[model samples]
Target: MTGKRAFVTGVSKGLGAHLASCLAKDGWQVTGVGRRPRESAEVSAAVDYLQADLSSAEVIGGLVAKMDAVPDLVVHNAVTYPDRAAGRPELDTIETTMRVNALAPYELTLDLLAAKPDDQFCSVVVINSESVYHADADSAVYAASKAALRVLTGGLAAACRSTNAAVSTLMLGPLGDANKVEEIRRIAEKRGATPAEITRLFLRRSNPDLVIDDFIDFDACYLSLRYLAELGAVANGMLCRLDGGSAGTLV
Candidate 1:
């Protein structure tokens, strides 16, 4: 990233913010897309911000021009996870999840690749998750959406073989960020699971003897993002598991 440009999605907060900062610190001219790109203080320091919602392709058309020169690194990191439904939900959560998690990233990357065909070491990384192989009480939409992304990564990588662009994917496990934990809990609770159920499985279950008072940390999220970014050259068109503990892996 010495003299390259990086574009990351979902940079309003969480892993996206950390990823943007890390890339800028590594000398990448970074641009971040988010719902509220204006007031992201962390993003402002390290990269330019665009208020683009992945949910709407109409908004993305205007934003694409800003990066027409095309970036060296593109991360389709923005995602939509579904809230748990106590009763069967009539709403098409899978449609929304699939569009945001899978289609938008695929479309965005294709546009970027078309403009930057001659660029060297261009990488498109999708942030996936362990949930792909594991089942949750109410995560059908989320799992299916990420599975779509996983398939896209493989197909895109094959397509990129003849070009300079490379495609890689990373799957995430649980992180240590409080906001992420809260968000997960909210989704879980919406599915009718109690807070105690969350604590027993996501928190103390992993540690066995630890305190339930623990919260997710930001550095772990940053480490996962940064690790994938750094591995772009060596890991072109490959899906690497970020979870060492088998969460993101099948075996």
Candidate 2:
């Protein structure tokens, strides 16, 4: 083992799982936090897993307090969206989304940074979304939350400069399974039109460089994260957008 350590949130699946596993393979001792236990035995074996609901600041604080030492790397990858099936965003939904997507990362980062050893190189990576740039009807609340997170990360970056730490954001486009084709199909049917027509409409509102098929993979996301983590303080205050060539596609 490299004796380097990492703490990653949202490790139950997807990019979180991949990051934890890949980091472990690279000899980092990775502690992964999520709401539920990892279902994959192989992944579970590779990571020291902790279960905690991130929406509660108290719970997040407690989790951090129990750590033996602040990790060298902290990745804020957990995210939640307002239930699009419930129609327009509700007050409660908006609050909950903000708590999970924005507030949790802020709280966790502050807590971790507060405990870091003096002059140690620490890297914080917030997994963000392209939705921060453009949002469809179903994504407005989520986009707002990510926008808040972006600002929070910027603030953290500034605060960390005195401590030899860095904060960066990886704003990503649609992941493999998150392509909104099914959502578009539903909207198309509701509007008495074809799915292709709805897709065209979505395209009009999206970035001109949008590539519908250029969905990102979990491995690629992990690679980008690894790069940032290795850069240490050199990547401070950076917002790296990984849009799979689709810069402003609606999330």
Candidate 3:
């Protein structure tokens, strides 16, 4: 991937930041977009950081203006993780999620593809979630938004078939995070059980064949990016599940 250029969204933190760092280390010129500045100086130095609120349609033009050229790879990883306890989610919440998780990426993909030269091979990677397949009561809206994105990804792949662009969807599972673990612990305490026991029960209920060991970590993002980068035109429309086989029949 040396000398290749990549545009990554949500690089201020989490998996997006990690992916950007990895790509820069591999000699890819990376441009990161996020609403806030990167917290880590080390990560900030690895890529050209651009602050833009992806939830709004107006941010698209500003984002494009910052890019030097159409990138070889585009990773859509930005998202809005709404609190499930917010009670019967408001319409605005749903709209914001849809705009940020689905529409923004779709628009950006189209814009980038349109700007690319005919001979350049561009790869678009959408970071999807397991919620699309395993929906729960609390995450109804979130799941729906991701499902829409999954559909959009399929359509984008088909549209790019006759061009030099390729689209890949990475359906991700649980990633390690202290706050998430704490949240699970709190829920487990309320249910009078250990975190491990609660987690096991939840996994079993979600899918009987799924094991707790199937959850992915930060490294999975890196692996997925590498796979998408190496993928040729023949594998343009691939929807890969990086959930350690836990998706089971859903895939």
Model 1: runs farther than 4 Å from truth? 40-44, 85-87, 180-234, 248-250
TM-score of each: 0.79, 0.84, 0.88
Highest lDDT: give the candidate number: 3
- Predicted candidate 3 versus true structure: per-residue lDDT over 1-251, tens digit per residue: 69999999988887888888889988999999887756643354879888778988889756776688999999999999677767887888889999999999999998899889999999888999888877788888888999999999999999998899899888887776556677779998998988887766666776665656434677877987789778877658888877756677645
TM-score of 1: 0.79
Residue 92's C-alpha lDDT in candidate 2? 79
Model 2 agreement with the true structure over 22-75: per-residue lDDT tens digits: 998889989998887556423556789888888887887798877878889999
Evaluated at residue 158, the lDDT of candidate 3 is: 94
* Sliding window of 10 residues with minimal summed lDDT for model 2: 36-45
| Root-mean-square deviation (CA) per prediction | 5.4, 4.7, 2.8
- Model 1 residue-pair collision total: 6
lDDT values, one for every candidate: 0.72, 0.82, 0.83
lDDT of 1 by residue, 113-225 (tens): 77775746677888887677765667777887888888887888887886877788877665555566677689778879975566556655553333334443456555655
Which number leads on TM-score? 3
